[model samples]
Target: MLNKTRGRPRGNPDTKARIAEAARELFLERGYKGTTVRAVAAEAGVDSALISYHFGSKQRLFGQSLNLLCVESTALDQALQGDQAGLADRLLTSVTSLWDATAPTENRMALQDDDTMRAFRDYLESELLVRVAEFLGGPDATERATAAVGVIGGLIFTRSLNPIRSIAALPSAEVRRIFGPALRAALHARARQH
Candidate 1:
């Protein structure tokens, strides 16, 4: 027999979906620091262990919940072979779109939606980052990617702190007007250093 769940009932696919969705919503609303397993289970209407069972742990669950659609360039796995200009365009579009799509609509758990946020330093050292860095080029890719992802993810995550919903809204030209030069500079610097 399945383990008698402790906090809430056992979950099926529907229930699992609810839990994951709830976890994402609440984590975004509360930030990783503020959210807890109990709270996630409550929001999901499933036992807390079900969350553990489905996701292994809070961090893993959080990562899984954040598996947003990836742009092809960023998905390269290892190599900056993609068109640099195209990669820049896709990166901005995907990030901004994901940020916009983070709205806590359907389930609307007592949590604001956010595109995603890793635990900063911890996530930076994570396997996910490792793979993403490899996609940028490899271990050496860190310097190139770090600045770009940091600024982009920071913008998306920090917007959550604002009371205003549309604060993140910006035209592509404007975004390019700002980060484009800096990112270009960063890539060049990395190329020189490497």
Candidate 2:
């Protein structure tokens, strides 16, 4: 025999998504540090334990919310999988392809908003910076990583803004060919001491 006690239900089928949506909204509203698991759970109308059960931790939840645009991006992961050699070309190509595929349907307008952009930039700096620094693996890894992120961010910004018609018209291959070496230079530049 089993005994079950419930008022409404133990869990909602949409609980995970609700939690994610709440976290995303809170993160956009308050930034990472300002948002807490308890707050997210409250916003989602679930228990804090559910958040931990779903996402493990606040950092992981933030990462998942931040990645809503990119999703899994297996291509990007594959590009970063192995040798550092030709990493710039692989990374640039992967990222450009991903953006090109999603640009038309995705809400590019969200990026135009100041608050959204700031939140995204903060997420990128916190998440990508460390990953890139580790991937570069050298005495000046941090500096090179920062430069690489800047170069990539600049490229994305210009493409998004589309200030130049010709530049915008260029195919992904051409764009990759042109920017890959520049990215390489940014990532591989001689370490400068500060």
Q: Report lDDT (CA) for all predictions.
A: 0.54, 0.71
Once fitted onto the true fold, the runs of candidate 1 whose alpha carbons sit more than 4 angstroms away are 1-13, 18-81, 104-121, 124-128, 162-169, 191-194
Which parts of model 2 are misplaced by more than 4 Å? 1-13, 32-42, 45-76, 105-107, 161-163
User: For each candidate, what TM-score against the reference?
Assistant: 0.48, 0.73
The weakest ten consecutive residues by lDDT in model 1 span: 104-113
Error of 2 at 102 (Å): 1.0
Residue-wise C-alpha lDDT for candidate 1, range 38-147, written one tens digit per residue:
99998877778778777766666665564432212232322334655455555555555544555523112222333353333344344334544666674457776776
Q: Please give, for residues 42-155, the per-residue lDDT of candidate 2 as tens digits.
A: 898777877878777776687466553432335556677878877898778766776676662252554666766777677557656667788889899898888988977776
- Name the lDDT of candidate 2: 0.71
